[model samples]
Target: MTTSAKRLDSAARRAQLLDVADRVFTAHGVHAPLDLIVEMAGVGRATLYRQFPDRHMLLLALMERSAQWLATRARRLAHRDDAFFRLLDYMASRIVRSPALSDYWRTTRMSDPRFSDVYQEVLNAFAPPVARAQRAGLLHADVRADDIPLLASMLAAGLRGETDAERRQLVGRALCIVQRGLTPSAPGGCLPGTVNDLS
Candidate 1:
């Protein structure tokens, strides 16, 4: 081990494992062998196990990392008029790179306690921006904060593409459609006349 590697404490080691695992899972799917993760991280199987008792546990850690990322990003975009849309752009970038993680999230039982916690984090991240957009007449009356997850799920449809470039193109197209639907129409435009924010 390098001198720096030797210096990593338990928490640091756990984080390092997750970082490596993120790349491995993105390339190999969540079912990729834990042994490979250990090998790539230059850590023993026991050490990996010490940080994550099992694959599910490790997956949960990754989910937490995702939620943390969303929260941090949401905070950063809080002040923008288009914060909600901007946050979605950031989310698409992450999801595109981490298809395996998002796939795992989608397949997991909705009732799972851990799943609920992570999903709630996602909801919380968008709530402020969603409300602001609605209050500002930026979003349609039918759009609600709870609807954000549905939009996110719709974005995941882009994941079907085999290539990263193809996936990005698909996500971009989907976002354009979604943003149009959520946005209030022009005067006498589609749906009822646009509700001007005027604030």
Candidate 2:
């Protein structure tokens, strides 16, 4: 075959492997065997190794992909008046639907230095909308930028219902309750705790 065609095929195979790896990793956690990924991708061991030299590299790629997805969505909503809350809902929905991914995130520690860059990317994307919401008095002034993800996690916990319909209802109710608490209070009144006080 032609060199150009071979290159195109290689690129396609690489992307296919990444997609398969994403699903497998999310479903099986980071420690999942590469053999499962290779099997699911329908690719040879050599091809999987060529695309991702190790499991760590594959996990990093998945994190990058998820970060990029959030960044893109954040950018699209940045101009809206309620972008902060909208973005929160977007992330919460993702967590509720992707149980494995959510479990992985919950199990992983954010303080790990290797994930700092990924964390920063998400924080940067969230910062502007958060600032805008605070300025407009839509979100509580006491709510710092970092609190958004934690809040989403809290709200998404309601998704542990038995059925999808039940989970959807629970998520909606949880968001409503949290959003109400997030709304600005009367003058001289704020949320019960400062941003640093999670307890």
Candidate 3:
């Protein structure tokens, strides 16, 4: 065990690596060197390896962390009628800050079974809020549960930005466009009685 690993318990050390990996993956894209994660995390290669056997493991852990955060955000906004919109804002903020994370995420196709848990977690977290928003007439009735991921992918196009400010600007614009299209009263919300179950 490394000196740092010896100092922290297993759970603490694991969490430390994850937090460091999150920032490193944000700054450098997902393919950033593992040695850099070790250097920034102040842990030995063995330590990081012990916590995350490979880059994919680390990346999936980050995705799971994100799902948990969204779940928490949903719970926090449980009392608000605008919970769904607030959740969209929250996701947009994350995408703006760490658009680089989208690099690896894009590679993980939805058909890949490895991503099912994270995908399911997303559905579990957002489905109800989406339904509530539609029922309240805040969103178009044509918008279905699966549409959330598709909408998020559209928003995440901001990841193409060359710089942080550019990313924020692009994501902001994307969010505005998305919000307009999703709003029930908006012109582009949907066609009358048309539904897109995406089946």
Candidate 4:
């Protein structure tokens, strides 16, 4: 095979492995055996290690990829009048569909400071839309941008079903309830508590 073709093949294989890893990690969690990933990807152990030197590296890549995906969606919705709610819905859907990822985040406290930078980027993406929603009185005046993740987590907790369709339905119901609570009771009305109030 040509060198260029071989290079393409290598890139494709790496992506394929990452794709499999995403599914396996989501189904099993970050600490799941590498053998499951290799088996699912139809790749050998050497290939897995070659693509990702170790499990931590693989987990980091997965987390970064997931964060990037959400950030991209948030960016697209940034200009909408209800961007905050749209982003919340987007996150709720993702969490319900990827329960393993939700569980992983809940169970593992990311100790690495570098991961905080990624988290900050996501928070930044969420801020403008949240501010817009508050200014427009679509959301309660007391709601802070930082509260978005907590609200999303609460909604995500309600997701459950035997199948993807069922899970989506459950998440939809949960979001509906949460959205109603989030909406201002009257124009410019504030919720009883702000983010600081919780603390």
The top-ranked prediction according to TM-score is 3
> Each candidate's lDDT (Cα)?
0.79, 0.73, 0.79, 0.72
* lDDT-best of 2 and 3: 3
By summed lDDT, the worst window of 10 consecutive residues in model 1 runs over 190-199
Tens digit per residue, CA lDDT, model 4, 40-66:
988889999987899867766666777
**What TM-score does prediction 1 earn?**
0.86
Candidate 4, which segments miss by more than 4 Å at Cα?
1-12, 28-31, 110-114, 159-166, 186-199
lDDT of 2 by residue, 1-199 (tens): 8999999999888778878876786567567889998889877899888878897777776677777888999999888868887777767576555555655665566798877788788888889998998889888778887785677677667657666566666666666667777886633333232221111
* Better-scoring candidate (lDDT), 1 or 2: 1
Q: TM-score of predicted model 2?
A: 0.77
Candidate 3 lDDT (Cα, 0 to 1): 0.79
Q: Is candidate 2 or candidate 4 better by lDDT?
A: 2
Error of 2 at 177 (Å): 2.6
Which residue window of length 10 is worst by lDDT in model 3? Answer: 190-199
